[model samples]
Target: MNKKRIPLPWTNVYGLARTLVALGTAGTLAASSAETLFRPVATIGDYPSCNSTTAASLFCLSPDDYSHLTWLKWLCVAALLVIASGWRPRITALPHAYINYSVFSGIAIADGGDQIALILSTLFVLPALGDRRRWHWEQPQEQTPETRATRLLALIGISGLITLRLQMVVVYLQAAVAKLPHAEWQDGTAMWYWGSNLDFGPAPWLDTVVGPVITSALGVALMTWLPLVIEGSLVVSPLLPQWLRWWAMGAGLLFHLSIALMMGLWSFALAMAGGIMVLCLPLGSTIRLRADEDVATVDTSPSQEAEPPDPDRSAPSVEQPQPSR
Candidate 1:
């Protein structure tokens, strides 16, 4: 009797999501200077908290001097680069979580993206810890027998992913539902106000292109209500079929991209894009594993081959001579 094969719950299904999260946080830090990210004044306040004896961040582990801080920031970037490259996930997972936590807790100015990255990176550590592959993108070999311990670890990792998915659903649901009470969102004037803002508004060049449309009443209604519709759909995306989930993912990404373009929230867009992939993508179903494909080929080969003819079964037997009988 063949032993049942136990599927490892942790696999390359979330590889892209991990990479995107790492890149988003890394890009934000790499693009900014130490001075901009860790203001001298803010550092004074946050340093003690971040550098506490128990929960010290890499940033807070050292002196808050500009040169040292700069070096630390770059080191964090290097670690994130490793994570983004999908290498040695078991080694890099905790470091990735630590880096995001440092950025969120130690930075002078942070956004929603930073918080999301922190949450996701931490959650990803569970899956990464359970995965035995050197690279996060690697699939397990076919017919690999999982030990009880490994199976438990994989289940724990999968639980973390499920929690992450539920968190994403709540995030979008709250965003859409919370906006319902706002007068501007209700009246459809929110987009116009946001578009016309000086600090976070679209660049002058972009404004020139979208100005006419945003200024129109119809455009305002669409812009304001469209996000609510998209966000609501994303909230229920887990229950949606694969195709609809994909559509929701596309719409969510587009929505975030528009914010990035208009409000210069590139990090936010990247972080949310990763979340969308986690929320919408069906686990273990996105990429076909080479081992599985090989198995499939092997399974079909026998059917394709013409069976050898059974001489006695396929051919009529000659009648035996009956004269002696």
Candidate 2:
């Protein structure tokens, strides 16, 4: 049997989603390492490090022990970078997920984005165990049982991506719903309070420009109601045409980008961006064959090729010419 190359684009989609989740988690952890590692509130020395909490943590050392925590953090970062770069993803995925789970476990408070990203990290491990082939560029041989299993694994991984997109839409819709009863969200004045705060708002220089604008009725509505509308729209975005779905995802991306730039929530932005990639890629669609493969098909049965061609009987018969003519 001749081996055929199958172009399964969802494999690439899954791979990209995996990379984004891994890299986004790594970046978020790296950004918040100081607090996660040694903060007074949730350091490795915290009372619940080993005994009280049900959550699993990598930082099980005594609060006084700083040396081991430092080494472990750096090692986790290294492993994350390797996963993000797509160099030896199968080997690094376990460590990436473990370290992230442990860190979040030890922390006093965890962001919803980070929690979801950690879950996605664990999900990628299943796909990594099956085949070491790179999904973004090439796929393994097709039609073999092993290849089919690998494809199944890849589908499982892509399902994780789909789950992430659904999770994001749910989160957004939930937020919007929660705000429905609040007068601030309804009157479009919520941005005024949020934008005026020094902790969550833009830096002093930028706030000077952004503050006044948000205080106005139109600006407030734009900032507050726009998100609600966008979030509601995203709930149905997956059902839209692929191009339109991408446009909706792009809008979500812009919303997150604005939050990152204006509100200084980089982790949330990155996590949302990762979810966007899952929807942007062609995850649910079937693969298309190359032009050369379009006209080529394998005949699995010898009898199929040996079958006689059908005769046509619909045409009119021509008159025979006489010998004298």
Candidate 3:
């Protein structure tokens, strides 16, 4: 009997799926970290947590609500690592990738606003697609190139981490800038307002420690001017002195962590964790490519060289030039 062939629509349907996954990874990692860190995690005796007034439904995420978020965050990171190792990520990743990206479709679809979940989906899309130019209609069983896997993995290393840092900078900067318009933020009153908020149980004393007068002024300062300074520095991180940039990075984490503790924005904490990617950025390629990182190569062949090339072919090939004849 002759085998009947099946047709594949690589574009529109399948292509879109891939794009969504890339964006989802970035957005999920970034947003989840922020959401998890800034907002409290699921707990007893509370309505669901929502991060934005724009999506109040989002605010009501349960312990289960955040399940997909954290799961996707780590899963993407893991997929990136495995892909970089060229361990045939397609075999294991497609399943996890689908789950990592797709679960939130309903939530995003249900609650509209240019698809926030889509943001994460878009971020992760490039890493997952392997080689868009190389894509061809084929069965899932078709062998995936190790080069494609490796390159994609490398992209995850670069883009995933970089995107997270950018997101962190954006988050803090946006918060800081938004504070600028608010009279309270300018005078540091917003900080006090946050400190004074009683609903953030088990921590009423934390925000209120400062007398109301100081609270009011600090609130304005934090809500207003601080964002300008943070965002300004964020713009300059690339050009700023390495030491200062590093300190800014540290201050960012500490400041956010403090917010998490006092304001109880647990998702924000998680977002900060995602931003942990920034710390890794300073390390030279030696460390990041895992050359300095001692671990078993994906290919454990004893004869194969463990050291990657100076320009590792195994690393993600952003745009491969045709080899010179």
Candidate 4:
């Protein structure tokens, strides 16, 4: 009995990571646009047309950027999100693809590192990304010419993902560079300033226990060096001992969280943190980990192998279970 051993590079892991980047790019764009369209009113007096000008205003003083919703964008975003996750229909997935396309194009036109990566990836990369629709058809019971073509398309999707990863790497390096010249970053004082800012949410009182100077000093080194460690180490990320990468990723997540909190870049933090997780975790394990997490079983084991299949090639046909939210 010959059980075909597909190489790790060709497995479902890359599929998940790439999908996340695409999905995330789409999400980030959608959210940022929404915020732009529906930002908060400067003061309560500005809400005359918004609601009755009464003291006991039933509505939220500053609803989660509510005034920005248009039926069209919402509908389109809904369609895209569904398409990004749908299992049985490519048509449903079209909106997600279109949004991804738009994002990539927009990013490219902007010429910044993030946008450049976005444009390049969307144009040359995402066509091979797969969902259940592609994979289900390739199974033994369902294999057909149509299925094979879809699988080939999935390959294209994986190619886009490769560019997407390259894109993410560029962002990591660029951000690290941005923080390089600041004396505060070198001394950790910049992080302390960031931590106390209101945009990052209220500063926690607990920080008083550790003198601000000490905290700031530690923050400066962390702020300056963390990205270097993560981005530079990426060459060996999937190759180094799994524990080492995981440790690095966890630290990266913490750093991103601090960025989100101190600098008020929450969405950016989340997306970057998610990206860090995507890059650091073995490409082949996402679907399994997702599935296991859903069923309330957690796998804590580490993979010793360093070479994860390049999701850029094999990612498209892997199945998606349920959308995370």
Error of 1 at 306 (Å): 35
Q: Give me the overall lDDT of model 4.
A: 0.44
Worst 10-residue lDDT window for candidate 2 reads 298-307
lDDT-sorted candidate list, best first: 1, 2, 4, 3
Best by lDDT: 1
- What's each prediction's TM-score? 0.82, 0.74, 0.44, 0.56
Model 3 poorest 10 in a row by lDDT: 298-307
Preferred candidate (TM-score higher): 3 or 4: 4
lDDT (0 to 1) per candidate: 0.74, 0.61, 0.40, 0.44
lDDT of 4 at 1: 40
lDDT of 4 by residue, 71-112 (tens): 333554565455345333333334444444443332212123
Error of 2 at 267 (Å): 1.7
Ranking by TM-score: 1, 2, 4, 3
| 123-149: candidate 2 lDDT, tens digit per residue | 667556654665332333333353576
Q: Which regions of candidate 4 are displaced past 4 Å?
A: 1-69, 84-94, 100-155, 196-216, 219-224, 235-241, 289-325
lDDT of 2: 0.61
Candidate 1 residue pairs in backbone clash: none
